[model samples]
Target: MGSEAKGLALSAVDPRAAAAGLTPGLPLAEARGQVPGLVSLQADPAGDRAALTRLASWCGRYSPWTAPDGEHDQEGAAGAMIDASGCAHLFGGEAAMLADLVARLERLGFTARAAMAETPGAAWAVARFATTAATPWRIVPPGALRRALAPLPPAALRIGAAEAETLHRLGLRSIGELETIPTAALAARLGRGVARRLDQALGRLEDPIDPLRHRTPLEVRRGFGEPIGRREDLAAAIESLAAALCRRLEESGEGARRLMLVLHRVDGTLQEVTLGTSRATRDPAHLKRLFAERLDGLDPGFGVEIMTLAARAAESLTARQTGFMRERDRTVDLSGLPELVDRLESRLGAGMVTRPRACESYLPERAVAAAPPFVTAYPAAFAKGPPRPLRLLDRPQPIEATALLPDYPPVQYRWRRLLHRVSKADGPERIAPEWWREIAAGATARDYFRIESEEGRRSWLFRAQGRWYLHGAFA
Candidate 1:
């Protein structure tokens, strides 16, 4: 939402693009080089998926069948597929609900393409792959698959890369060609992927896209003193709330994957914060630390009256076993999260603790987000990824300088009216967004290096366009 875009892919919209000349899979560099003035950003899959999940949850406000689509398979951000059939009248009609959803997303800066159909697979294909000028999103009558997908690309078939490639090599680029090929020969050569894709496209195969909901038990609360304006006051309120909340979770025989704190302000506005743990825990102290790091947003101008805390997305609770020969730890039963959340809210604010969520997008910055206190835990582990700063600049700031090599640290650098000399340095971890990411081609590559100043202080460093900028701090 800043210099870098927020949701959707940067590749989705490039400012330099003329008449939207951009094509899928085109190198971001070449695309940007074509449009020198393109402004772009990295998308956040985490935020996107979280928003989608919330939408699915909010769908209950409309119809129980509403579900989100396209999210991280892990961490409960897996988006969903919904069935909005004869239930259209539930919201006055399908068109009205669709309009309402679009309006809701638009208010949140989301542009969506929605379609309704008899089958989940067909609906999904139409929602994303359908061209506006061709078959718009709608419920086609029975026996309409041939008319719906005959002209579309192979992707609408939901086939894998290898089969799609084979079809492309044979000049069978559209679904129509594959349809014309004998099913027997196609199955003989390309095997099940091609056959299954064809079957899915034609609605002969049943395809199910499940809505992601954490199986964990949950508890929620709506507080009367919503904002709790002062930081300390908010923290105090949170403790008792957390304890009460934990007691609810304990009764269910499951541990929460996340915890959400919703502050329905006196003004009817909603502010949320979330927290997560490395392990399933109701440890109050640990939650306080996590929340303390992020509680600056709760201004508590008037006062918060309604606070709702819900914990969903769960797993069966298990006591931790200590040494190989030892039994489970006895103290593991302590659900300290309430006490910790209490201290943190009082110290930080009413709505401060949060946990990171995984989003399903190819964009870098859009891959993770601080979920509201609802999601109770973080990824057990992340794959090898770009080096992240212990402290990251709220936004990337351009620097003034030249670089023979984006390494060896600059001899001198200036920031916020201070100048410093470099003394030591470590590597250049190159991070690049996907080709289809909606980011500027010129800024696609970031070389993050660890640098030490003459004062013997280590800092996170990065160079863009041969200019050096200090990005973060390191202990």
Candidate 2:
């Protein structure tokens, strides 16, 4: 038996329990007396709330705006709300979308009933009470909200239970009956709730829904009369969406960094494909290339009926000069390098392509680090520093060396079991140990040199603590 502080009561019940005359909050002892061999389990309100949040997120395929309905504490949630205003046309129509939403939830082992109206209050009321064979899921058409809500009880107007009972005793059984009474008379008795709820449901007052996710501003969607299943047709749809998105970006002077594609299948499933660019781009051709790498992975199960393209992240893009001078046009521009890097990263994972960035550290390995390729901003270190080696060692290798003087360049050195006699050498360039490092107390300053061996092979070597180390090789 499920136990609580109130003493062995049912916290929740299923259809079978309800059919057997067992209801929630019923004493377990009485439940067992009424129906022999009754069983119960502990309730998990927190887990239920968490599941509701996830379900709200998954509802984004229908609308970007979805919020959990009803106030919740430790008791769990009531339900969820989806704002399918502009989204319904994509799934065929308002009635079709409502039916599809309920059917899909039922397939996922959930009992769901959905209603769409111009007002949230009317939708909520119609969803709970309005039952008709012609419309499986309720949909109150515009200008017909009052007629649709006339049959529902005053309790369906979201009034308090006690208030509903009081109104019922006063013979105000239906919303239409309540509407006939004057506002002042109803407020004198029912305390303004009846009038407020009636006004909210009949579109006399505004009702706003707070969404769980942020809605992207740059989104374009297209719906088809018939479902499309061909790969070439999907490609054409994507290309068309990219072009439309570029036009929108151009009007706003913004470019996309990350983009997402949502394909709504006829079978009520959603297939998503996402791609990112190395640089903010408004070029439709470039955007197509990035999405092309992952387009093959999409499965248009039962055909796709609607497709949406959205820019998830964007940045300001300034206009660039397209027409080049005759003489200057001969010089090749490296501005297109970012596109190349984006293509490589898209084809072979983002980690595969990286750039070397200079860090604020004295140690050779710590001084330079590998980072993602930069497109918009370039580091100041590359512009002001002296020339570095073409290739640097992961860590400096120790070597045996002899120098002409104590603090001078190395005259000769042996590295990796090979001896090299220095024919020419440059003066020592000193680098101090970083004061913040833990090893700074015992660390000595490094004196670096550019040395050319007898074979004219140039190398960068540094000396610290009376030991020589090969740091890099010059090309």
Candidate 3:
């Protein structure tokens, strides 16, 4: 249930509730009046989002480019968007694919409605508003989007609530009626959003789907006349596929970070092997070596007839000039580091290798974070300021200190049951909290001090809100 202008209201309802004259957005009291024993539970938006994400991931079996569509106007109904541009033939055809998708969803106890068209906008409209009880799915042929979408309501255009209400008041109930009005006149009447959405639905504008998982466009495949099950043959095929893929990446000035090898067995079963690199690269030999470490124990069910290699993730890479001198320069060459990391991760596992990266934060603890080795972007440069301690405490330790002045370094301090007299002191560098962060109430600036005790032990101390704390130690 969710709060409405009137009171607690139903955010969703099953078909039975709808048959009893109950609908989403209906007040809970009124819904109970309609059905005496209506059962309800509080809404979990986060859980719903997570469920939708999982559903989108599950749909990846159909197409790699899939994402959860939770912004549809259909009451209590969520959807997923799939870009099946080149994937239809794998499942026989578009019609067969759609039928199979719906059948699988129904078997999973979900009341599903699916549609296919030239554009996502039209498909979304037809799936939710155009399907009938006899047929819960529809496929609008190419160039038939306008004809199919004409009979749908204006709400199917994905306009705002106020816009739909305004369209209703203007006597423009159906999409056909709205299309009759000129573009300029419609924009003057309802704004550009309506016109843009209309154009998107009619395929005049481009609407691309941002996939849940990024899949690289560079790919190469090999089909054998006779199925080969030998490990040596498979290894050779991987080398050839890797070479072809690398050629394509070099042509596009890109490099792959992640690669997926799909082995299609003659028995209709598929075996997949995935590998990730520490940095983007287009070296076919390197890619082959990386895959060699992961191809062991792969089951070649009846026989593998088709092998497709796809670069699942990629990044832009350009050639760099090397020094003209034959002798090695004094500057350190970290180019081999990425290759080392790739081999280690390939043997160990993805995400098992990491490195520290600087972050954009003023807080000492938040200034650095762990990140994947050899990330594409360069690390942020540290600000030139006072030197930070070599080692920082996990959490600042409280200490009793006495200072001659309110804003000066401590003359003496007691920490961990030990007392020390300050022999030398450096600063009271004041650092203010980041303004953009959501700081707690009464949060104040910190005054840091670098001091050496009589025993020659150097420490970093900070004072906040009149309380002194030992934050770090110098080596």
Candidate 4:
């Protein structure tokens, strides 16, 4: 029953409930009175829809074009549509694939019912309303939709409850009853929706199902006559596939950002692994090394027969030449950094390593930002200003100090209950506050000094107004 036991109705029922003379949409209280041990659970439409989507994704092993069948009604459960047109032969034949699909689903604890026809509408109708309890699957041969749908009810034409009731009152109960009527007259009397659905089922009109995922354009595959199980053989095959993919990318002047490896087992199972790069790349050797880190986790279940490599994401790339000797000597070459990042991410994870970037800000902490280590066109250069410390405190630590009058540097200070006497000191370098338009308070100037203590340690100190604070320390 529902939370407050208020107007509770049956959303669905199992075969046991049907055996006990109880149907869906009946009052829960009345059902309990009729059947002594009736069990009722609240409706979960969203959860059912999510499960349908997951089922659709899992069905991709059979065919890439798969979609969820319609939304679940109060009494009906949801289903998935798999367009196994050109893919059924891979698993022996259409009949074999259908039996395999149903058997696997049954093993997974789903009382699944499936059907296949030349038209989507006919398949949907036959799966739901035509098949009996003993015969759960119905396969209509090509050009047989007309004969297959003749015995089903008018509701199998995808009509609503009100439209089905209207048809029943007019004595047009079965789909065969409408076959003799003229199309225009039938549409004019019952409705256009009924005529449209009927035409689609009988192969007179087109009704296509949209797949949840689009096939990647940059994909290459190879099917072997015999299944391969050895790791060495798999590695060689991967190297060849990567080389071929890189050649294709080179021809198009593009580099891959993400690559997916799909292995089709001889038993019709699929295993997939994805690799990502920090930057666009077309190098076959580098791509192979990235996959090497994760090769141990990939299981060749029952031996793999068909292997495919697809570049899921890519970007245009341009060729470049090395700089002159003098220019190269002055700059550190970072060409190997991207490969290192790919290796680290392959072992640890993506986004686990980051570098600080320079933002256009005057505030010391805000000036540098940490970001994922994606390759940029230009490298960040050190800003031309007062020398920054090796490490900066989270916030400036307040200290007690005395200094000469005016803008002189401090000679002695006490920080964290420790006294330090200055032996050598630099001049006070004035630093102005951030712009007035920044909407920040304490827009006062600071006098910074580089001081050396008697123990020979260097520290960065700044004075705002009459108070001194230790901001950072030198290495």
Candidate 5:
């Protein structure tokens, strides 16, 4: 790697040796010896990836469908791909988005190149190889990919190293040279991924994006000027925006399921906070209260000048059209759901906190799991079964024991350290395994046991394959 890697060990003279001339896969010692003035230090991949993820998250303001492209971040590489198909216009059009993206990256002290195209391949090539100033971050103009990628070597298409070496040997260095070659030969040598990438970049094939952001009903946002210097000023601005957005919802008889507030500082940094409600709601007071909980965290280091409020996962707002006579008179309180989700999500990460979900497996361990994170938008479920356990272990632990009634609780048990004596015991609740999903299809049956020890400690235990383990304690 080069001195541009920030901490990669270099010759202590020139900081751009690797970025300037040395190639990847070359020994750093050799690279340093060759480039006399190289200055470098060791690079941290973890830090680079984390920094890129943060930048990618910040880029979510422009397009929620953005995702980090690669896992490795040794040096000279770190970026995200934004799926801008349906999101470009939301940012005041593509040209504005490009300018904003560039300006934001510059403020963050990053060298960035943004490109817009009909396909990811085209956008990737343009962003990686084209002249730094392409317009419209989401819309790909005709022939733009061709003009943008022609000068770069065929390796820009991300073809394998061997194929690049072959191209170099055959005097076909630029992408234009490889493009002129017959497709059959390239396909025979490089396999399908290469030809596909080339065709996709040239816009000759249909390449649909699997967006990072799933399709939701709507998550609309509105921004305001006049820096909100005080909490009251920011709150007032938010209430006004919420009221305006609620008007749009009221017209369609709909309401927001979740609301997000984004405060963009004058220094190009962004602070975003989200609130979820139990039921669909448009109450400005409730919304103000929710945002107020996390308001202090939104520090405006350079003074926030732009405030954006977005309403997400909209639901039909039920209203008493005629208090005494209306079909929608009995409205389901959806606001409560978001309120709980917001509170729990605030303490734990959106992924860590989730609702119990009924899983479709007979194995007790596989019968339940957490719902997808931050998604309060699942449709109703109709699966019904016996009451599930209030307490379940993430994984079952093995125990040594001896049973008395063959189908009763363990008379003596041993696990981890000490042995236990079961003075009282309950019958076994027979449970079966999901043999169909078994890797080798030889799983045994399980029997649940609820036991009370002489010490008055009650435990809900289970036995499988001649083993007894305490799964949960009745407190």
Candidate 6:
């Protein structure tokens, strides 16, 4: 029950209360008159939000991307949104997934109505408004979002109660009728929200789901009956911890990317060992092997009483189907690369291994960047552009050059107090500074040229503000 301007009102009602013609926002006195023995409790909005958040977190079993539905209606009913893309196949199919989800929720004493569609908005509409007693779950097939959402009322679009009332007064009761009217006309009559919501429901506009943040890291701990100080015992403990953690990760459809092993020593001190993988993985044996390398120099320090292995960072990693025959397998298994990188990092140090990653930038220096080994970089996009030098200088060196006209390739340039005459030169390739970046006071466009010295050493030279600089050398 909630307080209203007049008196106490029903904030929400159970199925029995709803069936007895009692609705939310109805006066408690009138609701009691309609249904004599009405049981009503004071509403707790904060608690409801917290409960919904917990429910959303629990939904991580279905999909890693899950969030409590931010939109609420007059009835004060709460819901959760799950982005089950690429996850449905795990539970058989979309229909099976929905059935499983609803069945699990029902087992937990929740009356859930689930619907799947091309978009979250459509799913929300269909799940709340279109679902029936016969079918508590519905799946709007791909490319049928418009038809599925057409029959829903304007209120189903998640518009404000007043806005929905206005749409109803204007004889636009259904979403189909609202869609028939021009967006601009509807916006003029109602507001831009109606059009925007309509577009989102129909998949015309993208509606992104903001997943709930995990407050605590997924971890498993073990308390030894006797404090273990020996290296072999510690290794065995880690192996067990890794297996248990991997089991939890598999159950949640997640893989650990970074892990932290916390050791509570008997001397009231703590020892920590952190391990990071190049990619997400849940293989217990691989985790044990990786941890083995880091365990060499670990000091048990008077014996460890408790050991906790926590997955500091994790990501969704679905099950993969392996081919029966290696010869017939068309896909390459590059899983060994991450294992190698993890091994190297364990021996050397974190960030010791790196790979060149192509970046979206026009500046030669910013075009390529050092990234983690597993980060995939696409260099094919740069293939269409002029070839970049194999070796680029850390910083462009200032040089003296003699050229003709306002924009021309240098005829000769002096670098490091040595003069080199240009034998053959390519025309200047003009490159403008990125406008989106902060421009310095004297920053100007660069005109680059591929020039070869008479002695046969080719260098990349660029002229900015009529000053020449050697940027890179070509092999």
Candidate maximizing TM-score = 4
Q: Which stretches of candidate 4 lie over 4 Å from their true place?
A: 1-6, 70-74, 133-135, 176-210, 217-255, 260-274, 282-285, 295-310, 320-337, 352-357, 370-376, 379-383, 393-409, 413-418, 424-448, 463-470
Deviation from native of the Cα of residue 333 in model 5, angstroms = 12
Ranking by lDDT: 3, 6, 4, 2, 5, 1
Candidate 5 structure, TM-score to reference: 0.60
- Give a tens-digit lDDT track for model 6, residues 366-399: 8878766653333333535886788899899999
Worst 10 residues of 4 by lDDT: 319-328
- Candidate 5: which stretches are off by over 4 Å? 1-15, 71-75, 86-93, 132-140, 206-212, 215-217, 224-227, 247-254, 316-475
| Candidate 6 off by > 4 Å | 214-475
lDDT of 3 by residue, 442-470 (tens): 66788999999999999999999999999
| Residue ranges of candidate 1 with Cα displaced over 4 Å | 1-20, 43-48, 55-60, 65-67, 71-80, 131-136, 214-475
Can you write out model 2's per-residue Cα lDDT over 75-168, one digit (the tens) per residue?
Answer: 1215677888788887888978888787877777776767888888888788767854356488887899989988889877877667889988
Q: What lDDT score belongs to each candidate, Candidate 1 first?
A: 0.59, 0.79, 0.84, 0.79, 0.66, 0.83
Cα lDDT tens digits, model 4, 418-462, are 899999889688777777644387567778889989998899898
TM-score of 2: 0.70
Candidate 6 deviates by what RMSD?
Answer: 15.8
TM-score of each: 0.41, 0.70, 0.60, 0.75, 0.60, 0.51
Per the 3 Å backbone cut-off, how many clashing residue pairs does candidate 3 have?
0
Best by lDDT: 3
Better of 2 and 5 by TM-score: 2
